[model samples]
Target: MKFTRTANANWKGTGMEGTGTISTQSTTLNNAQLSFKTRFAEGVGTNPEELIAAAHSGCFTMQLSFLLTEAGFIPEDLNTKAKVTLEDGTITLIQLELEGKVPGISEEQFQELAQKAKAICPISKLLNTEITLSTTLTA
Candidate 1:
């Protein structure tokens, strides 16, 4: 199966001084404000790296859930945080931290499944930067 999702960005003025708004098809971020200040420094509104982190975390969590179910484990909770590192105008790395509670699964099994999910998640595949994952399996 194939599908497409899109977001639109409208910008004005020069790169350093310009501001923009991003609207997604789902309207979850309708007309969200973004600008150079938001991207490079702490400011009001969102930025591209923040968006990518959200997407990666969500995607990896969902993929892990699927894999857990397929392996006959029911997950009580799966929390993931993605950290995107941008350096010198390039995305250097993405680190995924996962805390999971799955009944009847060993820590090793959980770690293995999380690794598989990280490698196979759509967002992980789409990114061209180094990806590292740390997993915590809890009761």
Candidate 2:
């Protein structure tokens, strides 16, 4: 399988005053300079790591939801947060924090399902970093 997304950026002045655009025929973009990556978080567009984190978090949540449903414990709400840490200019760690309200399931089962989700999620498989999952079953 193959996929692609295009982003365009224009630098008017120095590093600080430059801007960019990332469009997938999508909702919106920014005028922040997201070139070279060093200018990240400096009034520029969202970085690659940030987009990756968004994809990872969304994928993991969907995976967990599917697992919960398959396990016969339909979740009332599923929330996931993914933190991406950069190591040596490459992504090194993806930490997933999950909280769900799932009735008729024990903590152990929730943990088990979460583990499966972590392993089976497509985004987790794509990432080369270690993934740690912390999950909680809510009332």
TM-score for each predicted model, relative to the true structure: 0.98, 0.78
Off by over 4 Å in 1: none
Tens digits of per-residue lDDT for model 1, 27-121: 99999999999999989999999999999999999999999999999999999999999999999999999999999999889989999999999
Candidate 2 local lDDT, 24-52, one digit each (tens): 43445544335544435444457667778
* Residue-pair clashes per candidate: 0, 0
Q: Residue 25 deviation, candidate 2, in Å?
A: 4.8
Report the lDDT of model 1 for residue 98: 97
Model 1, 21: alpha-carbon shift in Å?
0.4
The CA-based lDDT of model 2 is what?
A: 0.79
